[model samples]
Target: MASGLGRGNGAAAASVQLGLWTGDAIADRFWKFYGEETSTRAITRLQFLEHVGYLLFLKLDHERAQRAGRFAQQPVAPVDAWPNLALLSGDALHTGLTTLFDELGDQQLSDRPDRQTASVVFRDAQPWDLDRMAELNKLIVEQIDPYRWLAVPQAELGRAFSRMLRDCRKEIDSKIETGQTLTPLPVLNAITKVLGVGPEDIVIDPACGTGTTLIAAYHAMLAANRQLPPAALAGADLDAQMCRLAMLNILLHTGRPFADPAPVRLADTLKRKTPVVRSGSGAVPTVAICNPPFKSNGVQPDATMRDDFWAYGDFPTNFLQHLAITLPQGARAAVFVPDGVLSGGGAAATVRQNLLRNCDVHTLLRLPTGLFHRKGVKSNVLFFTKSTPKPSGEPATRHLWVYDARTGNHHTDTGNPVTEADFDDFVASCLPEEGFAARTESKRFRRYSVAEILASPKTSLLLKAHLTKELGDFGSPKEIAFEVADRLDEAAAHFRQVAEALPGQ
Candidate 1:
């Protein structure tokens, strides 16, 4: 009879599975209730969903706690109401979770004989367990569809999501104070699009912040496996915490344990004693990508760093040089550096000139500001390849192509961000044949001959001044004549006044 009822109520069962109670879905129901009860108005869709998810997680956690206490024969303490957990104000859930972990340590279970037995008291007691944390983070990421919510203006929502991520990190840190990771989605997408990875290529990200670049490279290699096999991906970071996170992220996303148990290392790349080649075969990476920390100086040159063929001592410049040295001959690289590196004087200028002469310095993608989490610091991607030294008197580079996507491109933090579509024209302009055809007649993209670049005072690749010249005159002939006439009239009046004063005397 029960089986028959289940078969008959398939639609009802499906609705329950979908988290729908009667007419409205969970998200809609929460928003409707808030609209009816709350005094405040104008809540965004993302905010409403975030509020609902927080409330649901809290209730679920409480129920789980109650069940665990009953099963373990423990005294029931007063339940913490956690009323403000659903507020979506600021890091409330993160703070609450931290506090819960602290309080849980005090609870004693009669069923547990020893410390190890008591350790598994609650479902989340061992939250820092890598597998468990990854599962929880995956659940949270699934609930919060980041791609869909990317367009949402609710920074409150972003804060809530970031807080959850921080809590995940905190849990991991509590157990094994090392190996935390972060993969910024935008950067990952950019790399996969720009450099299609193959099995032959050994990819590396030296400043592998949370292993995002390495993981992304791995995925890209997998995606391109139809034509080529997967490439070996490796990374190193200065922060041990970041290395941990990178390992965890890689394990979670790839479902494959790192081939080397110590896939990540905690060592400053700029300092001496840094290893140029991997152990054993002395294999160098064929492809590299990174957004290295931009520092003017204070980078101490260590023995290993000193031996770096690309070393010039400037922090970002040194990183650029290090990448050049570590990469195989004729290997391609894409690195992000500050605007100052492109046109700065002294060592920076020398490095830039050397890079152009030694490598096939092909493309420069001028990025807009605020694309990074950091503010105000403008950046660009220098895509070049290390090549064999050209014969004397022959130009290493014949034509330098500049893509001016920076000008007229503006995006606010709370509004729309620069997307792939925004870079379509710039990408088109980069093609060898299309050249200027893909670009607009603005101070954005202009080609420079090898001779022209050599003739420049600093041999700088600063495209703005050159681009402005390409833009031609902004003032019309009539506008120029009117300005000249006005200046002449003023001078003539002053001369007449001077002559009158002298004659009268």
Candidate 2:
């Protein structure tokens, strides 16, 4: 837990002990207005909650500005600062929000902006009906207070608050077949560290889901003492709802809706052009970090791409390939990919070959099963950089390091939560001063020359692919048979999904 934050009490469950919330408690808050309602009601209410939260945060922020002239000369940061909104009547809040909404689009106010200025973002915007306005005000009053919300991270707080309004699984499933699962915090920390992102870099998450990766990157930049605005980081997703959520997620988490807006493009990154950013370099960047939709199966085509990713494979393979080929020279990337992308014939091999021959393919951290909400998802994070193109016939990956953190690092229950500590060694090893070149071998971490990788059957990059397994050695015959059956079932599900998406089924 973050210091000073309280964990939920088991003995005092009946008592009103505010501020302490267990993981299940948090999840319950998310499940609130979401699961049962009709789609329209669910999403609208959820969007309303986000709007109200943004307004509430701004109200608190403006209070700091008001108090600066009285007791403090400088504005206060939001870390522990609290401004009581419980006192604001429903009418007063409705009026205050209405006024701010007008100013957000006002040309005169644009000439001389203030911190409390409005932010008009795209996606499911707030509704102006009186019933919703009244409901939003009451919900805010009943659920929010200094005691309960002062320490909550905005993204987490936003999700919890919105849950009371809607989960809208149907609305979500229409966009993503897989349940929307966040990139676990441990995975987020490790990937952020490995990318070596600094203040000077322009970052992007091509498949930013609710903007978790982008928001995490924002905090990382702040930790690095970078004054970069929210616009420095960008995200793109095929879902319009997510685009809007990404915009709101960034705003609420950073407490800076007024920061110059970054483009959260609502385009399939694999198939369409990203929105133009103000950076004058269009949409490509210094660092591309993504846990893209692992299941996008569209037979998408692109003639303009400098490389033929389709000739290489399918939805996610091409998505990863797009990021690899389009990343500006010298830019860095950390991508979460399925095990299939590492090896296999046809397009997968082609894409792997291009990555090895061109990009300096460096680290491959093969993730464990059960790391995601999607059980049996065997994933990996491929960390590489797009530097100058390699010479003809020269492989860009001279030597590649692989880290296996899967076999023994299993999370079978909630109490034994996985965390960033589990990946400490891998994070430290990725340091620029002691990267793959300085790394040595271990049972969990190993290295292979480019020749070794290409010489492996089918250019398979998975380091443990060749490690032979002894059958029925650890368990009784019946137990071993069950285990083999389980493995087959998991593989069947993965391949079946792929087959369902093929052109002819």
Candidate 3:
């Protein structure tokens, strides 16, 4: 565990002063920021999030400036951004932002070789609000009360900004043709707990949308007092804007120590043959957790991995198989894949079989619907360990535990959002260090032998026998007696048959 987390000068306590409606207010303000042009929610949200993400970085930079004050004498440092933010108006907002954006181009300390390229590369890679900074200032006043609401601690601002953007993601579900759902904070934390992520351990999220998994991992290590540098984290995204926001998110959470290379890279995991992460301690993902895009252009589940070529297929399935195959031997991963990956036929079935044969398949927690932006889509987290070469007949996996959190529990993006507390039992049961060997079947959690999974024609991971959908929780006395009697009678008959068939008899 890392030490001295949450001890930063600008770090806020558990209780932040932001209003309950602050996230909603930010959402409402963004909609208003774009007048009555009435574009698709997807585009509108991208524009809004782009500006807001930059704003978060700007706020942190301003706080850094304040901390660097020089006795209010000998003229303030040339890079102070807070002084202007206080009296920010149209031109002031633009000037402050422009100066900040321009400063990001400095390659004085960049790790890249090309000094000029490193300076402007970050800005030039993504779409900009530089030309429209003045327009955003009007939106800030007409919508976000920048002076009043933006004065919170840098950490709080980042959390609030992230929450608002996730809320907006719910509205863009219909407009988006691709899959890029945000992982709920509680779920992300629970995953970290299950993985037992350490400070020195290398972590990667290949399908890192806005980098929530990586962000959560960062905080987890921080909370554990495990002080990890940006080198310990890596993430990649197909979208440029997502990569940019993820970069900002890492910058915000690792506050005060803002002098490191951004670990996020912009790349499509499926399209790239090589690694998506360009610079880290290494390209290997020791502990991988990703909610990769689930669909392949709204097409069928035809992703393939034969003869060194695959034109198209289920994206999530391909990513999962890729993670399992590419991860270093003995590496473990927790993948968020749709339920189809569990029982779907054709290439999916082959991949599932391969995963089972090679990996030490541990647990499968069926996630509830409404947990993602995709409505009515059931998902599951596959926890497995990659093992080395073994005998042909012997399988790496033996007993498998399946936790059915989705059956009775329910969650939503809003209203009743899932939190870390919601995953208490699931986390306890799924963790291998927490007496995993002594685990037994609970009401919502059950243990299945690997034989049972292999016996299934589809290699289906569904394990809902004890679920409410199967048997009544509180059966009548007669029903209980009958069930017990049936078990005893069957056992007795089997024993009698075996006894009669003995050679002596």
Candidate 4:
């Protein structure tokens, strides 16, 4: 697991913190500095993030080389060798940074296959205004020490980056698009626990946002087997900034070098010929975990059409179909989908029917509303496995288990983040670790036959739990407020769609 860190660092280094500036604290300090920069300078949040990403990359690489004693015998160092050179003022710092970016670009092209990846990350990346860039470097070196970054565990560092990204977007306003949102970590943990990822399993997230889902899967794999299997992780994102963040996140989490090609790349997963493939084995992904963008428009008209486009439903359903068709038989998937995918009519219903015919749609988990950065957004997690077709051409799914974790579970983004405790009953009842134990059903958890599920109008999978009087079969005023907020959000979304569809919008 500590393969990338040099001699004195490993499992022992996981808990090491330098003086008072811990890893989490360092990330917080960076975020605070980011706010100051964005507020004072003329730079946007996106531009500042790009600047910081480059600086952090350089600092981390320098720390790694020092720990490994790479320059012990060298007579003279390269221009980029001394990260401390960033502390200089005016012309010296400017010259040092210009040459540093140049040397880094040249080194990235040192390999053949990695050139394009380098171009994607380093394209248009040059030094910003001297004063602003110098301030950022000073923050990294003086406040957040270079060696402190290497002292903490890689997973925590990766998570720190994720949190910082989330905070930057949430607290500060910017022109950045709202297409990507990081999945909450507790929710991610619950999904990975249900999937039970192992060392040998190749996990892929086609819509990876900052590589959160992939990192969670990596940690799950490490827990299953005490080894680092970075090559088994793969992801892709359409947004270039998101791809950059995912690359940095993966590098930090896996302790891989900046030069190595991350499992993640920049591409539209739906448009790519092969959406998901293991970088290590070149085999089909054994496990898929996705949280696709919500309510995105269908593919462009110029793009080639395929049957699995599935009635031109939203991206979530299309991504679900992509998994249903592309994954090999017996491969498993756990996808975070909106309530519309489970309950909406027309295209969504058809996709659900086709999914049942092709895959064993086993579990439906109704997640709490406002569980993401975006409020009033209700979502669900569908757990399923690809199955071989039956001789008699019957549907693959037999019994469907639905867990209603949403009703009366008024979890907001700030007030109550979803936690492992929230998933205890749901996990123990259906998703046990070892073997197939008998699952005891409760009021919130129920089992339904496929025929009964299909009998519902439009074959909707949004089944409500039958809570008894003892279980408090009622909604409080807070629940009513949440419902109202959700309805208002839906109405606002509908208006936005209408406005967008109008001429000259």
Model 4 clash pairs are: none
User: Model 1 segments beyond 4 Å from truth?
Assistant: 1-192, 226-231, 258-262, 271-283, 303-305, 308-311, 393-395, 412-414, 431-443, 465-505
- lDDT string, candidate 4, 23-100, tens digits: 476577666776664444566656666666666666566555555456322111242455446456566777776766
TM value for model 1:
0.55
Candidate 2 residue pairs in backbone clash:
33-166, 34-166, 34-167, 312-347
Q: Roughly what TM-score does model 4 have, to 2 decimal places? A: 0.81
Clashing residue pairs, backbone N/CA/C < 3 A, model 1: 179-244, 179-245, 180-244, 180-245, 181-245, 181-246, 272-302, 272-303, 273-304, 404-444
The alpha-carbon root-mean-square deviation between model 2 and the true structure, to one decimal in Å, is 8.8
Q: TM-scores for all candidates?
A: 0.55, 0.68, 0.71, 0.81
Residue lDDT tens for model 1, 1-505: 1111111111231112322322133334344444554333444333333333433333333333434344422212225433233222224445554455444333343433222111212223222223233323333333331122212222233233333333343233222112223324554556455554566677777777666677667657766563322226666766544554454444334433122223444466656333232334345567888767654534346755366454355566777877765566777788887778887888778777778787777667776654543233466788777888777845566667677656655443335455557765555455435543353333566667777887787787776523443332223353355335544654676677678889654
What ranking of all candidate models by TM-score puts the best one first?
4, 3, 2, 1
Worst 10 residues of 1 by lDDT: 1-10
Tell me the tens digit of each residue's lDDT in model 3 across 411-493: 66765678777789898776645477877778878888889898998888766734567422323354355345544654676
Q: Candidate 1, overall lDDT? A: 0.50
Q: Where's the lowest-lDDT run of ten residues in candidate 3?
A: 1-10
Q: What lDDT does candidate 2 reach at residue 372?
A: 53
Give lDDT per model, in order.
0.50, 0.59, 0.63, 0.68
Most lDDT-accurate candidate: 4
